[model samples]
Structure formats: structure tokens, C-alpha cells
Target: MATEATEIEITTIGRRTGEGHSHPVWFIREGKSTFLLPVGGRGSQWFRNLRNNPTIKLGATSAKAKLITDQAKVGQVMDEFSSKYGAADVQRYYPGVDVAVEVRDS
Candidate 1:
């Protein structure tokens, strides 16, 4: 069977409220790692929450997230997203966005 590598359910702890928050979002899986990007970039609520806390749930898996600030890595992830989901879709959903979330095995 093929791997399902498109979207994932991410559960994050709310920074202010201290409650669980879930969001279904597009993801990129490469080997043992996964990556995510906010459609609206760094100003997004989830991103803000993640900044406050890196621990998160990726589907049924517990993972630690690192915000990818390296310009080259961010560009590469963006390219991978464009290739997997198509440029038009990326443009439609994520315009002028460069930040990325790298979710590692925990």
C-alpha cells in the first residue's frame, strides 16, 4: 500500500487558553520526517501557538515541531509543496509565505 502523505490532523496546545486545539492541514512527508506550513504564514494562530510550544500531535503520533527559519530549507520545503500539491494550489492557498514547521519523531 502507498503512504498517505498529503494531509494530517495536528493537535496543539493553545498558548493562552491552555486547551487542546486541532487543525487539519496539508503536510509533506519525506522519509521519517514531516513538514507543515501555515497558509497565512507566521501570523497564523497555530504558528503562534507552536512558537509557545513545540510539542504536538500529528494524527495519532506524538511529534516535536521546529520552526524552519533557514532560508534554504524553507525554500526547499516550499518547492516540495508546490510539486506535490501543484503550483496553482500553493499560490491559491499560500501566497508569499515562507515559514515552515518541521515535525520530527519523538
Candidate 2:
């Protein structure tokens, strides 16, 4: 049961370099699913990495990851983020970005 305030480390394989890249990011968990929002949007490097490989490391846990571009689903996930972090904070940190990463059992 990960709280929304919890920051988790995510590692992705670099698309070009083929190296493991790790970064700390905010997460929202619902049941067994975990969601990540890229503050930097689609152009973000980690987002690219996840695109290159759906497999990602969430701290000690390994999960399959996928980019979520559907507007409705993205909005739902954003709502979860907003609910946890507050709308103001989420807007401040994730301005103009609708992209997200969804993690589930690999």
C-alpha cells in the first residue's frame, strides 16, 4: 500500500545507451497498480526509456510499465494524483502534461 506522498525510485533501460537509469519520482497506487506522471512530458528522457522498454524497476519491485496516452484514462490517473497531492500542487509540478506511466504485474 504505497501512499501518494511516497517517492519511489524507477529504473529504465536507456533506449540508445542500453544502460540502467534510475530516478526518484512521485507515485500513486490503486490496488496493485502504480502510476507515474512525467512532469517533463513526452519529451522527458525517462518517458522515452519506458517507451523503449516496458520493463522497469520500481525500487526493489519489478513491474511492466506502459505509457498511458488515452485522454480519459490520463485524466482519471491525473485525478488520482490531484487527490493525493492536491490539485494546486499537481498543477504546479505537472503543468500541461497529460502523459503517465502505468505499472502492473510483469
Candidate 3:
């Protein structure tokens, strides 16, 4: 949730085409790492694309296209994201749907 409105960028892969897609998201930093909580949950195109392939491009002012995944790091990721973005927004994401979270390398 700690952001500067500087246009945090994240590129996700297309599940079927092996293509790359980019999105300007609110990239949040916590401690020494960073995370991106899809506000739309698994149903999100970006989230679904990520589920298909954990590898994607993560960038801020600088770009570090890396392979990221959802591997049981949700609690920590949620903590940081919720701390800044507020538990309401993150929780509201797919409310009653049990959303997913992941850490992206920056």
C-alpha cells in the first residue's frame, strides 16, 4: 500500500498464447520485499494468467521481469498489503470468494 502513484507496472503472461501483457498496478512494498494483490482475485484475467504460469515481469520505475508464483506466501503478503492498502480493500477483493495472494520479486 506504500505507493507514490508512480505507476507500478507488472507484466503477466497469457495462459494460452505465451504472450506478455503489462498492467499498471499499485505495487506495494513491505520490509525488504514487494507484493501485488490482485484486487479481482483468481477470476481476474491477470490472476488467472498468473495461475497458468507463475513467471511474469514485475517493474516499478525500473523493470525486472522475473518468474513469480503463488506458493503459500499469502499471509505475509496479505499483512503488508492490508497494512497499507487497508484490510477492507484486500478483503473486499472477491468477498466471500477466498482470494489468492502472491509475492513478486522487485
Off by over 4 Å in 1: none
What lDDT would each prediction earn against the true structure? 0.85, 0.86, 0.60
RMSD of 2: 1.4
TM-score of model 3 (CA atoms):
0.60
Best by lDDT: 2
Q: What is the lDDT of residue 61 in candidate 3?
A: 34
lDDT at 6 for candidate 1? 70
**Residue 85 error for model 1, in Å?**
0.5
Question: Could you give the C-alpha RMSD of every candidate to the true structure, in order shown?
Answer: 1.7, 1.4, 4.3
TM-scores for all predictions: 0.91, 0.91, 0.60
Give, for candidate 3, the lowest lDDT window spanning 10 residues: 60-69
User: Across residues 19-86, which tens digit of lDDT does each residue of candidate 1 receive?
Assistant: 98999999887777788988878888898899999878988887788998787988888898998999
Task: Quote the RMSD, in angstroms, for model 3.
Answer: 4.3
